[model samples]
Target: MANYLLKRGNLWWVQRKFPVDVKDQLGTFFRKSLSTEDADAARLAVPQRMREFDALIGQVRMARDEGDLFANADEQPALDQMLVRYQGQVLSGLSNAAQRRHLRVLEAFGAFVGLNLTAQQLASRAKPVVEQWLLPSFGHTDAGRRALNVLIAFYDWVVECGYAQPPNAFSGYRIRPIKSVVVSRKAWTDNECELVLTSLLAEAERPANVLARDNAWRLAWVVLLGLSSGDTLHFVCEAQRQTHFKALSADWHKTRACWPEIDPYWVPGLSPGGPDGRRSWQLQKALGRRLTSLPGSLTYTGLRHAAANQVRPDFDAWLARLQAIDLSPAQA
Candidate 1:
């Protein structure tokens, strides 16, 4: 037969001749190791191997004739099943973190549409999901960009496996910067840091409720810690005593990879989903009010850049100078 099993040393391999029209593109014969040494195993593997080879042949032929947009006439599987197969077969050997992220992207896609939907159905609905869900939700972040790339790659794999049609619905998506003015993560200048700290300290010292006082204090440290420790506003909001900080002077690099600590001060009234919904939002609101007096649009991210700039050969010495500044009354 044209497609048959062959013995290669100790393993069984599948060998098949390419159609004449696609021989130049796909080679004369497709040869793949079946990873089995037993003849019985090779014989059992025939039907599935034949199906895979035939699907590949159909994809090449369709790509040539219909330009990658046509699906094979064969019955297609459910979207969920296809995703699982794609992850297991196509991305089997990829890094676990990458694989997990890809699956998460796929899951997000499925949530937007329906996992039970077929490839053809998914292709039809992809544009709206791309514009509405993907762009609005993730258009600004690096993870979003990576997810778009992964989605495109997954579709390409689906087309190649004869699981879906082509011209890939997600192929046109691109990752662009969210802001027109692309500023690098610049740390706060010495003058800017002094201005920010002095302003926040004044706010913290004002008579206020525990919630208001704690929010003001933490928000201030968020700026100082962001600039000095390179921690994000989000990280500052979610910091915990047991996880993020154990003592005043702690080494974040020594902690687990998932939990990164930055600030030395322990926040008293910080809780998950305070009256403002997310604790991060509370910090954001407090910081936003204080930053209103400053020139230019200085985001917390900018503070992180400022702190990064402060990192020099004498980082400890510079940190000591920052630590020596009196914020004890506010901290108390």
Candidate 2:
């Protein structure tokens, strides 16, 4: 039915000329055989062929819009030489870490453009290529802004050193700020808590790696301390023996909040002071990584909230009852 459909002897075919704008990239005409002499069958296939033609045109147009439809040939030594000069001139005094960070961004751009362009050619393509790169690569996050900032600085140096002309391509481009989402720290449900604990205990028994086994065993005890006595990961990590109370205790370093006394649960091959005297936050990260493989979104901090939710209306009575329970190291 479409004008693009035609008959070549016995076999039917579809053909259409590409739009003038995209003709160079996509060629003059798109032609394909329908592989059928039956007119009714060809008619039914026409719609699908037309859809394919539309899709090809759409892709070429999008690439053109992004200024990447044409492939540019490699220009020798210009971009690399300029980057070398930039390091010596602008980045000389910066720390090694800062220098590496800036250079990494420039190298990424070089890689994106196939390492094939003069400074002038790169500058000309910078605007569209950067806009395309930023949206899909980093979106509106701070990392995107940081990368843009790095490029803007690089281009400013390029212009200043006469590698490219005035009007910096990367200058004045700002990714829209990301909208802040307030995450609610809701407590895990009873069944969810039970599931996570069961999974962690099971992992502790037969983890494929030593690190996984150690983290799983420690996390099981950590979750139990939080669920039983509202003990935070930090408190549990830094807990010390209290001779008078005949149990372990720790004070919250930030708020100076005292934790309810509870007996220590030790796992084999792990110290309460952490591996090689690692800090509480370090241990929390190790344990958190282990939790990620389990079902549901569970957090170390959320366990404290779960404990608060469970022991409502009578805190002292709940603590007393929890302390009365005979918890052995093997139970963990």
Candidate 3:
């Protein structure tokens, strides 16, 4: 049995008996029997809690000399070390996936900021330091959101698992980030596009500035096909009209405006410009013959821009193009 002493302000003192070695039960009994709405409770509770505190101090000194049962490898029974032991015992035995989240949060932030803090020290906690100071800037990004989610899930788990005797420090927290959209992406220049178009056309067209009517129309056809295939551009050209979702698929009605389940159809010896060699290449070749044109190569990406950019401008059009194919704008 241990006797607790009480005090009033800095002067009066009283004593009583408390019978436990546990920490919380003593603190609770100390707070309740001593604290009051009126001066009388403070007067009554102080001396009693102080007496209990003295008993606990004596018990601590005795235990420190008794044995190493409560000691760790370092032989220190500090609160930090003690909490770790409690965590290993209680947190390890708990099978709850959700509750483990809080333990993770405690492991992350509790060591430096939360645990072993004075009541005055809590006013300078780290959670708000990150949320109010750091997260305000980065919280909008994917990395920011992920970090906040990890901490929150852990905090929720901790409280749910009864790791704390009361509410956890993480509750009522919000992690909203600022919203902003990216408006631009890289696209090939018209001169660069002209070169790429040449590569996609017939072998005879590679060095020839003067393209036949069929080649010009073929290039135009291919360019339009690639561009409108993106989300931003909804319109389709003549060749694409047949395979375009509106004309080809019954599912387009149900799939909203999205790409749905379309797969790429790769074929050799075909330019995106047009399979039909029917028009306008003759005029291009004559123009090229009239004045030698600087040549450009048509790559897969270049052909895509040539086909699409005719309808939409660079950024939104590129974005739309990516969206139509179900690719992310971030990739663009």
Specify the highest-lDDT model's number: 1
- Top TM-score prediction, candidate number: 2
TM-score of 1: 0.39
Candidate 3 local lDDT, residue 75: 37
Model 1, 181-256: lDDT tens digits are 5443544566777677666556555626545544555555566456545777777666665766444354322222
The digit string of per-residue lDDT tens for model 2 on 1-332 reads 46888999999999887654445677878898999999889889988988898898778655544552113333234676666556655664466567778878888887777565777788778777767775678788888889889888988987776667788878868776697632226577777676776676667656766566556655665666567667766655555433121343432121111122233322223343545563465667776776676666667666677778883223243334333333333332
Q: Could you report the Cα RMSD, in angstroms, for every candidate shown?
A: 15.7, 19.9, 22.3
How many residue pairs collide in each prediction?
Answer: 6, 0, 40
lDDT ranking from best to worst? 1, 2, 3
> 1-332, model 3: which lDDT tens digit per residue?
12343446653344443322333234424332443345454565665567666677466445544546454443333334434444444443444453355445445555545466532243335466466643764566665665566555444544444443334454445556665532123344665543433433333233233233333333333343455454222132222323444442333222223323242321111323324452323433433342234343223344445445663434333223323332112222
lDDT of 3: 0.41
Query: What TM-score would each prediction reach against the true structure?
Result: 0.39, 0.44, 0.29
| Worst 10 contiguous positions by lDDT, candidate 2 | 251-260
Q: How far off is residue 52 in model 1, in Å?
A: 27
Please report, as a residue range, the 10-residue window in candidate 1 with the lowest summed lDDT. 252-261
